[model samples]
Target: MGDSIGFNVFSFFFLFFLTDIAGVSPAIAGTISLIAVLWDAITDPIIGFISDNLRSKYGRRRPMMIVSSVPYAVCTFLSKEIRNLFYPRNCLRI
Candidate 1:
């Protein structure tokens, strides 16, 4: 449920934000989104393969999930910060 909501929010807002505020054309924004979707589709199976093959004391997937959380959070934070800093005109005020 959470994942679904997050994906929906990201997809809807990302396109609008890119085209409306960031001055990207709709076609280009759509192409970029399509590329992202394709990249995600390609990576899912690769990550699943890795997770299935991984051997660790903590288990196959849990350790990877735990270890990846910090970097994921950091990346999310940095992306938002960079956008706010470098694209203040397009940044959402909160």
Candidate 2:
């Protein structure tokens, strides 16, 4: 099982911080998260399938993992940009 307490605390704290402390609207947060979830749902399986089918001297998963590192990091860094676009700058902290 997962760490339920940690997950719950994180979820509560994050939503509270976003909606109350940070002044973000609930609808904006939900919309951005929904889009991110959908994007992950579509991309993750494709990435896993490609990785699993790959045949290389360096190894299948390892190669994909290595290649994906930069893009993943970049995406994480740029996620705020997409999120910021969904909400007014005065209403949220980027």
Candidate 3:
């Protein structure tokens, strides 16, 4: 679905930006990303399972969706942009 595509695309660009543009070593970037992907793999299924079984009055997934939507979008944008704009080396050399 559309949401899945957004998540996939954002994750791909996040990894690419980290390794390629953010000046992180490729090995570290890959390892970090691999760990994140594995964590996502584990968490997504559990979240989906819970959402599928919920019987809340406000709707099973709506609350989570609402709570996560803004933060997810904001963090994705910041993740892509913030790293390039300010790095530890730049900060420390000031």
**Per-model TM-score on C-alpha atoms:** 0.82, 0.56, 0.66
Off by over 4 Å in 3: 1-9, 83-94
Which candidate's TM-score is highest?
Answer: 1
TM-score of 3: 0.66
Error of 1 at 52 (Å): 1.2
lDDT of 2 by residue, 12-60 (tens): 5666666786578999877766886799899989988888899999987
**Candidate 1 residue 13 C-alpha distance from true site, Å:** 0.7
Per-residue lDDT over 10-89 for candidate 1, one digit per residue giving the tens place of the 0 to 100 score? 77798887898678999999999999999999999999999999999989999889989999899778756766677656
* Reference-based lDDT, each prediction: 0.85, 0.74, 0.78
User: 1 or 3: which has the higher TM-score?
Assistant: 1
Error of 1 at 6 (Å): 2.2
Q: What's the residue-level lDDT of 23 in candidate 1?
A: 85
Task: Pull out the clashing pairs in model 3.
Answer: none
> In candidate 3, what are the lDDT values of residues 1-94, reduced to their tens digit?
9769977787777667666666788899889889988998999999999889978889998988888999988987886557556765455331
Q: How close is candidate 1 to the true structure, as a TM-score?
A: 0.82
- Local error of candidate 3 at 4, Å? 4.9
Give the Å error, residue 80, model 3.
4.7
Cα RMSD (angstroms) for every candidate in the order listed = 2.5, 5.9, 4.7
